[model samples]
Target: MFRPLELFIGLRYTRAKRRNHFISFISLVSMAGIALGVTALIVVISVMNGFDNELRSRILGMVSHATIEGVRDSVKDWESALAKAEKNPHVLGAAPYIEREAMLQGQRVAGGLVRGILPGEEPKVAEIHNKMKSGKLTDLFPGGFGIVLGRELAYKLGVDVGEQVVVYAPEIRATPVGAVPRLKRFTVVGVFEIGMEEYDSGLAIVHMDDARRLYQTDGPDGIRLKLDDMFRAFTVARELAAELGGLYRVRDWMQGHANFFRAIAMEKRVMFMILSLIVAVAAFNLVSTLVMLVTDKQADIAILRTLGASPGTIMGVFMVQGVVVGVIGIAIGTLLGVVLALNLEAIVKFIETKTGLVFLSPDVYYISDLPSDMQWSDVGLIALLGFVFSLLATLYPAWRAARTEPAAALRYE
Candidate 1:
């Protein structure tokens, strides 16, 4: 196989032993630094990607993509509203629901939101049925006055299935003496765990009829909708609102959780920039290594120049050498990062089991385990960035080597 003269010479220089071992050591250090930097970027970005995915699955799964509710208080004609929503091609399914904020008291007191859901239709709008930890969703019969509490909520209230708890509604009842808050005692028939601390600690479910009776409403509070594409919720909600017309309001999951997702996106961007600095620093090491190499190879450079080598070829030689170092580092780092990211969960679990140290606590982080989703796009971008920086770092030193005067360099010999 044939190779370019500059490339052959550059690669030869990379492997050659030098009188000063410090230069060789610095070159190795530069390669190692680049490798470490690339590895860190890959692992951290993958972890962030994993968190984003988990949030979408767990949070969105538990909430409706969009809701159509009465502007006044309750949707008296929710059936018609549901029908109209379902008529839209973008809507997957719709279910009626009643939501209220209440105080739950058992062994202790806790404040959270309560939702009235139809056991059969609930799965159409939310994934509560699939998340049940103990009892079945069907246990929440309309007239049975049964309720389902989230696992953390039940734990905090110190109650379990088959236990009774008191729920105080925010609505006030008019009495002969004065206005008083309405309260009801309910049997806990089921418990669910969504794995998100906020939802687990602040949500409860009951039959739709029980909610209507407890809140003194004639019909459902609103119609919850499931869309074909979650990202299209806002547009679909608006279209539904326009179609429904008259005192009908629309709300979507994005409206309620936009800030949270935005924060995650901002954090991801900031992290990418911050971590890129490490690769940048390592790239600077390439500059230092190449500078020292140029100084040590001045004699050979003069000989090559006298032997009819052009400045462009001399520049190509050093650039090839520096880029070779960067390419090797990037390849190793990418491989290590991918392996780590793919098995991050198992690795963390093993560490936790052996060390008995929990890195991500469900109570604090809303998740019990670390998640990792390696994106090849992210890996490719990181590699490209490192390569560009390494290539750039070679320029100044390579240019200096190219411009070296053979007359001046050979005078010292």
Candidate 2:
């Protein structure tokens, strides 16, 4: 259990009481700065990770991984397309859908995108069945003219389940007066909430047959496919399109939402680089602290050198001291960050409830609560970076201390 002389001396120097109280205060401040920086980086990164997961799961859950659309704007033979898509090993589920822009007039009027879905097959492709807030997806029936509205959309229209609404299709019919918009009255059979304002306030669903009748189409506009791995959606869609051939076009979720995720990624990187500056600044403080320490202990260093201590050993002593400070700060910060990240949702909720202040609104942010997903890998990386910065900061001051002229230093004494 023998320790290196340099390590022993470093530990003693770190623990020794300084005659200058300001130097000790600076040392404390440096440690606090590092701890603050590490904590911020961990918490922010974890929240970003949480947002990424939430966007992927909630958005992908409600939409298809890939879509096969007809070059003609309507897939006349969707059944065959569905069959072909399902035959692909990458595809986990496939469902036929017809989507169009429509206007709804209830207590109020609003415009939205309406999707036609089969009640039985819809659950396999989308999570609407599990996302119901008031009514069941089964409420949608052929020839019933029943429609499912998103919660926010329903709220905006002032309509609820079992209420009636008039739908105006984008298609125009020739009339005696002029071209009149095709319109129909429908019963609101179900309501759903997917926690995304864009989807919730701008989308509605109807039975496949009802949609076809309303749009005057014989079949679905396209087949939506769910893949085993969503990240591979683009590749799978391309391969499927090539396999199917002949006027079949493929689209993936990423194509539509690439910018959104890209923004998140870019913001995460910028925030990381920005927050890392805090650690860097604190590491620079360590250099200042060690330089002052070297100046204060010049006589001691000279005595040690005269007693046969090597310059390398002197450098090792200061390096060990700086590393000790960094390790302690990193450990404390990591523990605090993990605790905060793990319970971030609850903590935010509690704060909101107590202060009667809303951080996120369902109508604005799509999500109503803060989310956090701590990754040990991110924590490890932050800790390692802090250590490296601290070690680097120690080098110049330690080298200066190592190169001290013993004869000159003791001659002043």
Q: Who wins the TM-score comparison?
A: 1
Per-model tally of clashing residue pairs: 0, 0
Judged by whole-model lDDT over C-alpha atoms, candidate 1 comes out at 0.91
Output the worst ten-in-a-row residue range by lDDT, candidate 2.
72-81
lDDT of every predicted structure (CA atoms): 0.91, 0.89
**By TM-score, how accurate is candidate 1?**
0.93
Per-model TM against the reference: 0.93, 0.92
Backbone clashes in model 1, listed as residue pairs: none
**Looking at candidate 1, what is the lDDT of residue 113?**
92
User: Model 2 segments beyond 4 Å from truth?
Assistant: 2-5, 19-21, 174-179, 352-358, 361-365
